[model samples]
Target: MEERLIMDLVPGLEGIPAAESAISYIDGDEGILEYRGIPIETLAVKSNFIEVAYLLIFGELPDRDEYERFKSDVTYHTRLKLKILRMMEWLPENGHPMHYLQAVTSAMGMYYPARDTLDEEVRYWSAVRLIAKLPTIVAASHRLKHGDEPIKPRNDLSFAANFYYMLFEREPLPLVERILDTMLTLHADHTMNASTFSSRVVGSTLADPYTIVSSAIGTLSGPLHGGANEEVVRMLAEIGTKENVRPYIEARLERKEKIMGIGHRVYKTRDPRGEVLKGFIEELIAHKDIDSGVFELSKEVELVVAERLTGKNLHPNVDFYSGIVFNGMGIPTDLFTPIFAMGRVAGWLAHWMEQLKTNRIYRPTQKYIGKRKEPYIPMEERKRATAR
Candidate 1:
């Protein structure tokens, strides 16, 4: 006799291997993250965002000539076409930045067709254009929503510095530019994150890179994945004073509620990205002459949460300190996730490239739990049954 086989369903596919990827790695228990075999800590401190982006997408660090060429391509492509800019003007001003990002990104497919996902040239240019234009789109979204004309990207500025300039029409201070670049490197990729997973899934169908990235952007817009940084800032604001930190955390704990930014699904220990941002927060506060109230409050919350929750491996994640850093830089809270999308797009494109190599449309099996079969009644029969 032959035996039937069954598989247990895993909720959210937790701990299941979706694909064999060499793009990024995470060891939750050890609190390690790497992009293409380089430790995130090293990249965050030693490399700029563009370099890190090239490394992620190409699976190796670029030499001087390669870096210059890639950088030049990205820099040259940063400006949106006039029609795309006109389209942005018509979007509802009150919509979230992520929506603007998603719409514009998806529309890019119409303007720059990449239907041949297998063509190397098509993939290369698509990656360049998406990486280059996302910051421009994000900056434009923020400005247009506020009834302000969007600023243009400056080719002379470094990638991170240009983003800052486009957003505010002024170059970032030296330290701010460095921190923003590091933050981008830190967020460039993470293994099997929701957005990366979405990218791979969509890319499996050989979809154009723009559509793949736009799908990933939509996934990242969900609060569970990308909104924690904004929530962390809000939590700090509500705490309002160092004295309130412990009580507020305890109250939330007692009610079995989440402490925003205090935990991560993948990191059972301190998130390595959070540690890097934490150090930067300290450095920025001490040297930059900015208001440090949020930093101090964040420290208190960390201390309190550490004392109470670290036993369960619920320590602060990347969002914890990233919010403090962005808040200190005077970034509006709503732009946090959109900025996250900007960095994670590198990962999305990398995964999209990887997914095409072993393309298989994702078709996971489902366990059916609903009624198997039911006869459809004619309209008169249904009416008689209702009457009865």
Candidate 2:
């Protein structure tokens, strides 16, 4: 028998290794991120979202024939069931996008009957189905929430372009399409993030892929996680202009409150994905005119914040400039995190499939901090004791 070490308690299980994965690696101290040993920058510049998705879920970059087949499969499965489209209209218009996404994603399991939970081919195809369908679901939900009609999917378009088309029913500019592709690639996987962890935990129970991923979507919906970029955009809007950026930081400093997009939990330096997004923002700036002040305000705020936090080892994460990039793309703020889920579903499915291969239930030992064996007394006796 293997001896288990009695280790010191670490709150939130930070820095704990829960599972072995060959999917992604991050050197937070060096501000590095790689998918299957390929640097994020390389993938951002050289790979589209589908290509990266293949790399993440399959463990290697695909060749031409393989990629073509994968693309074909994904394209073929992009359309939602008629029932799913109708289902979105029933949701309250004011419901948060993440909540709708979570609910609808859970419904996928019911909508499409699973053949086998443990079968390898069944699970892989399930991953492919999710990668293909989440965009349709998100886009359909977007249109339904606003009383607009949903657009059908097109195989001729690239993965990013297809989602753009689905959302607006028009082809995105070439640059915008490419930028969204890189954005999705960058977000495809990280080293066991909160959502991915939730995915693994659920999958450990031998749950179906949709249920596992739905659990992950719920975990990712928190403000501190996937919603951070949405908050960043809101912060920039509140700052209003370059002049106000300084005062805004100073006041937030006085309160010692968190400045959204400024810091991340993992990377003590800068997030590598943030750098790639910043480069894309530069390209976007040169190619188009940004009417919103948020872009300029973000730049000025970054400079000020960087100067102020010189020794704190804090910097803008992926959330920092990503909101500005998406805002400029005309994506609504509420859809920001859902868009994140669309990209991240590939990773969630990857982790889910990986966990199933090992097939161990994730029952972790917890430190008991609450009162132990508190005696239950009769209600009248307890009330009389309280009176006494």
* Residue-level lDDT for 316 in candidate 1: 85
TM-score: which candidate is best? 1
Off by over 4 Å in 2: 289-292, 372-374, 384-388
**True lDDT of residue 71, candidate 1:** 97
Model 1 residue 367 distance off true place after TM-score fit, in angstroms: 1.1
Q: What are the lDDT figures for the candidates, one per model?
A: 0.91, 0.86
Per-residue lDDT of model 2, residues 66-105, tens digit only: 9999989998999888888788888998788888889988
Give all candidate RMSDs, comma-separated: 2.5, 2.1
* Residue 331 displacement (Å), model 2: 0.8
- Which predicted model would earn the best lDDT? 1
lDDT of 2: 0.86
Candidate 1 on 1-388: residue-level lDDT in tens?
Answer: 8995648888989888999999999998999999988889988888889999999999999999999999999999999999999999999999999999999999999999999999999999999999999999999999999999999899999988999998999989898899988888888998897889999999999889999999999999999888889988988999999998889989999999998888787788769999899888888779756788888888888899889876687888899888989998888899999888889999999988988888899988988889867999888767553654
